[model samples]
Target chain A: MSQHYYEFFCPVKVVAGKAALEHIPYELSGLSASRPMVITDKGVRGAGLLDPVIEACEEGGQEIVTIFDDVPPDSSKEVVRQIASAYREAKCDSIIAIGGGSPIDTAKAVNILVSEGGDDIAAYAGAGVLKRPLRPFFVVPTTAGTGSEVTAVAVIADTEKSVKLPFTSSFLLPNAAIIDPRMTLTLPPHVTAMTAMDAMTHATEAFTCLAKNPLSDAHATAAVRKISTNLPRVMENPKDSDARLELAQASTMAGIAFSNSMVGMVHSLGHATGAICHLPHGLCMSLFLPYVLEYNLEAIREPLGELLLYMAGPDVYATTPTSRRAETCIAAIRKLRDQLWQYCELPRTLQETGKVSEDQLEAIAHSALDDGTIMFNPKETSIEDIRNVLRRAWG
Target chain B: MLAKRIKPMALQARRLYVETMFQVMGRALQAVSEVDRSVQEEARALPDGFLFEMTVMPNGPKLVVEHQGDGRFQYLTSEPPRPVDLSIQFKHIAHAFLVVSFQEKTSVAFANDRMLVDGDIDRAIRMTRILNRLEAFILPKLIAERAVKEYPQSLGLPEKVLSAARIYLKVATHFVETARAS
Candidate 1:
């Protein structure tokens, strides 16, 4: 156990594998919820991913009261209120969120409004604000990355204020998470690579950060091994259902781990960089993973060394001496990054992204220092330290 | 009956420690808001009239401070007040003792589910930064390094000694004035 005292709670009933989508209506019926409101974006619907979920619900004698597929990539407070209105007007008894982080987060925010009886979400925009359980909710993630399906937090952009309002409560966790391979079969190779890297980063940071304990460590290691072994195979063959399923499950596992143990500087920097330069989140995670690990090397040396066993198989772990295992684990991540770059031109550096300039590093660093996750990092990072890491990661 | 009696006695001791710590913390925060550059910068980032509170739940010592803008914090009463901008409440007296005695860092306490914050997280994070800076000045390096996420590397021994002395003097003077007023 890394921590002497820790608390881990994941109430989400995860129903994964071949017929996970088919089980959604059964799960809903069990919750005594018959009229579900489906919240998703046009992209997931355009790709025809929502079809199976609808079919399953229809066949199970459930009525989808309404399908609001207009969720944006970056959901907003206004969007949440709009969805809440639709949910009420249609008399939805439950919520089934489909697609990735944005839609799921939107659904969670909508649940708060509908259940808590408020149009102003800003009134309830902090940690531990919700006092009661939300309406029955379920998530079927289309993207294999965000793991937002199981997290007890949601972030909705308050555009007028130009800030992201975060709501965190155990009440925000989904009643169940439905993970199926069919949802991710159409994901492009680059997306597959980047999202897997996001999961890998989540697991890696969870295992190494402060607050890590036995239970979260178990989930983190399992997630790391799954992503490491299966990411490359999926990158080679995107249509391979087994690999896709493993990656999706790994994403959820990583989500559960980080949600319990919390993530550290990699996420801090990723969030800051995304906020500043408008970069895709998965890309930012892939870009900064190695540099943040290297910076946190001394403070997290023991856990990083232990992670080598999961990142690379037993052959590599058994051969590397104890002192060198930490760096070797980082080297393995770097190799994976190189492979991802080859597979789909994922940017490995801030300079390569062509969106961020040298001057933006300071802003990113300032923003990163203010991020909540920075407190959980094993090593205390200074603004100058973050700037130095960004400079190193720039080229 | 003996076990029940002993529990209250133990609770009384822990409550005193927490109360004393809260008073000292309130004074130190008032001092740092005036003297520390980092705290001044952080305070400027916060909205004016931001009320911050630290307390133990269900009936324990409380410390409330109001930001009066221009990097100034006025220590409010120890009594619980209306909802504030940011409030960090230790779940139990023992948890407060762990943090007040420097046995556990603030972030560690949060990770252990020993405390809960009710307010905007961004403002809460800034409040934490201010607290970290306050801890760096008020506490000895060995102890502060454990209490805070990062002890300032810029403060040499001489600077730390001088800062601690200044903060401690303010804390003592405030307590003396309060005693006279009472």
Candidate 2:
């Protein structure tokens, strides 16, 4: 219940829906660039998602001067430095990143070094260090889970030190975020479900966290409603392009929502568990989400009630009593977890994650308290509270 | 020596804010801990030799506070001070004020790139909680609402008014004594 003086910012131009990639040239043209460097991971290329970017370049009468497709899953400073060198050598004017969070982040880091002329990215580790806007950059996210396409910060792994270096600036935001369903159409059902759930977590946390504002609430609510309506359809039929588009839009909207408002303890816990246990981020999100919702149940009941209405739609929301609506939201997420688990073995309990041991719970809790997202949790969490949440999440 | 390279007029303005922040933070360390046990509890969670420093971008008038054993904190010098624990450096004067003036919370400042921390981020977070308690005691309801991540749900109106006034008196007394000694 802090003050009403929340500042809002989202500078990335979004092009979402069918054939959005085709519109990339127009967006780049406005930035006064035609020759762009295409950056992606080998996985996205193997998945055939790069075809659209190639097709768009061909149709737009522009050729990518060079392609750097070996971006690692956890983007490293060395990788970014190398990519910056290649971009400079090829005389590329702009950057086009096509993949999930890693490539988008790598591209952002490379853009920083390429534009700012720094050999070491660690120098730009903290926020506001970059003095000006980076080179014209765009992101084509192949996965719906990480909204790195629209986010203003990049967390690139420091392979040497085994830590993630965070680079943040309004300047780090991409000039555009292109969300084409065609790009994410080939994602497997498990990946689809997990990423969509990740978007849902972003929206939920944004709506309920201490930083929740009127504008962010609107976007988060819309994102939750869209994800609720479309996640099932996309799960039932993976090829449903319409459902895919809605999920993509939800992910992007949720990204904008959380990046501005920030997420809560769920993300803090998720980040710790994921980093420590080497679990996938979206998968961690889906597992810890219900437990977090339950933990913040009383503190965020009003927003939880509203989310119940959004997730369940009008008909069910009407019948649900005010006292029980928050529980209803938690139950619905539990149901989704059960379904996703049945489809693909997504662990519902922390104990179910074979990688995590009982002994590691204390370490996870301690690490979570350090995470930047912990500040936004509605309840000021103590180490004990974190441990308790982990204990409940454990079983 | 502080930012000697900055323009004189700009430096003067920045120093006003910096000096005021120093006075306020010093008062908060003493007054809030006296009134609120939560501040003490939060501070007690940190290790001894914990240091929190604030310096404006490109500059002088930097302030560093170190945690004395138990839950007490006293201001220290800007230099190594036994290998500092947590340091928040602002990129510019306006960026520093964004948090100092209670316009944004520390976490929001971190998220927005308004400030940077160079050591022990978890310990930094623990220190932030302690700072939040001080803010509740020092700032009025309207101003505290922006600086604190979450306003205390149960602190009654009368005590809030009483604590803020107490903090103001203590801050004034602190500055007067420092001026006399100087």
Candidate 3:
């Protein structure tokens, strides 16, 4: 056998259980935090998941000094600055990011500002800009997807320029991640399906992308098995805490896998669509997963076949050679998406989200072509190819 | 013909060693070196009329190397032999080779759970000894070359002092980790 090598590094302490939130204080205690800022969206606060975290912090002798719950779905750079200002004024020693991608991303940005003392979020938009470490931060994801709890990236939309800026630094990774299934139990069916699909996309893309290594592949495969097995079960019974924890753990695993290895065209396209059309990030991922896989099948067939075997088992591709199984994997993904669509009644096309049109195709293609994730796709995708994928994804 | 004198056992053992060795070497070169096109081209040029094939796996890539000793090595991807001269199973191909070579982990493939090597114990021992000596000489030069290209600031350091410090730190850290694990 040919020799191979891998480097594994994810330092996020994953606290996963029915009452995983209870472990958050213990996790944070290691970081020496006495006062923490609870950062979340108004939606999460409205859903009542934030109260338990606050109570747990109080019971653990950790003070919640402030609650910045103004984060929106597509978090803007301005929102991050505002939250950072609030954090400073509150004199909080640490941050408890308690929402989905937006609040977590905002918390990351806020930490950057609080530590680095930068006004313009654009200044540190690229990779490896932060030379110093940030404050102790913990993530409590209320969705079973996004995997933001473990990722080193924080994407913030620059509303003024109308583009999403990805801030990446290894130091931006959270100190700990609290994945309580109880937090995700109340998610609406549409959000649940879209977010779970996002997790699956992360695992699948991580498994199939150019930067994939053996370590990433193992994590991605395990995540795919967990998500594929648990997402549907949780969908059937939203209050199934066991299934919810499985999905949550899957999302966390996918997050760690993709964060180091990177993702591919699905995320590139989703970022562009989310930026221009103002759709939910996970919803955009769900709409484009199968389409991008089909488009990039020729070049990424081998890795994609590995994903198929891991997700659906070897029998799914028993009749095909490893080289030709990419199409089979894409077809399986389409079938799964079809089932999820039927289950959640989510939009199957970009047009269903109200932005798909012949006129908008050029902008969507241009945006996707400019996204950094597109570069890591195994195939060389031109603007026209991106346009084709967008047109096909458009209903 | 040269084939008439070749023992099947030796041939199989050498083929397995070369295959695994080249695969690990190629992955390490790719990880630390920025010259991807040149490195891939060089990897495609393994000596001894050898053929190489690689199969990407969930844990890592498996490689098969075939050689006729006619100044060319052919590479192909296929199943590895159950009993071979030396077998190494690592958590990932990149880490297995890089950590062993650059991080100075002596026989990490045998010691760590991330990698396992089997068969022809004497040959394996000889190969590991040779690799360790080669790593001792080559790793510093490789790190220096990469540092100049990757981080220009390293070029200004006083050669003796900087080299001494780096060696000391690496050995110290390696010793501590190895001790803790043991």
Name the best candidate (by DockQ): 1
- Choose the strongest candidate by lDDT: 1
Which lDDT tens digits does candidate 3 get at residues B1-182? 56766667665554455446555543332232222232233333334433333322244546544433432222233354332233444545444444433442433223223443333222333333323322332345565332111222223336434433554454445445545876
Clashing pairs in model 2, backbone N/Cα/C closer than 3 A: B2-B60, B3-B59, B3-B60
Candidate 3: interface RMSD equals: 18.3
TM-score of each: 0.96, 0.83, 0.66
Per-residue lDDT for B1-182 in model 1, tens only? 99999998898888998998998898889988877777888898877788899988977788999888998887875553566888889899989998889988888887788888887666777888788888887787889988987788887888777877888888888889888888
Runs of candidate 1 exceeding 4 Å displacement: A1-3, B1-7, B78-82
DockQ of each: 0.64, 0.23, 0.02
User: Of models 2 and 3, which has the larger TM-score?
Assistant: 2
Per-residue error (Å), model 1, residue B179: 1.7
Please give, for every candidate in the order listed, the TM-score of chain B alone compared with the true chain B. 0.92, 0.82, 0.34
At residue B93, candidate 3 shows an lDDT of: 48
Q: How close is candidate 3 to the true structure, as a TM-score?
A: 0.66
With candidate 3 superimposed using the best TM-score fit, by how many Å does residue A245's alpha carbon deviate from the native?
Answer: 0.9
What lDDT tens digits, residue by residue, belong to model 1 across residues A39-81?
Answer: 9999999999989998888887877889999999999999999
Local distance difference test scores for all models: 0.89, 0.83, 0.70
lDDT of 1 at A354: 93
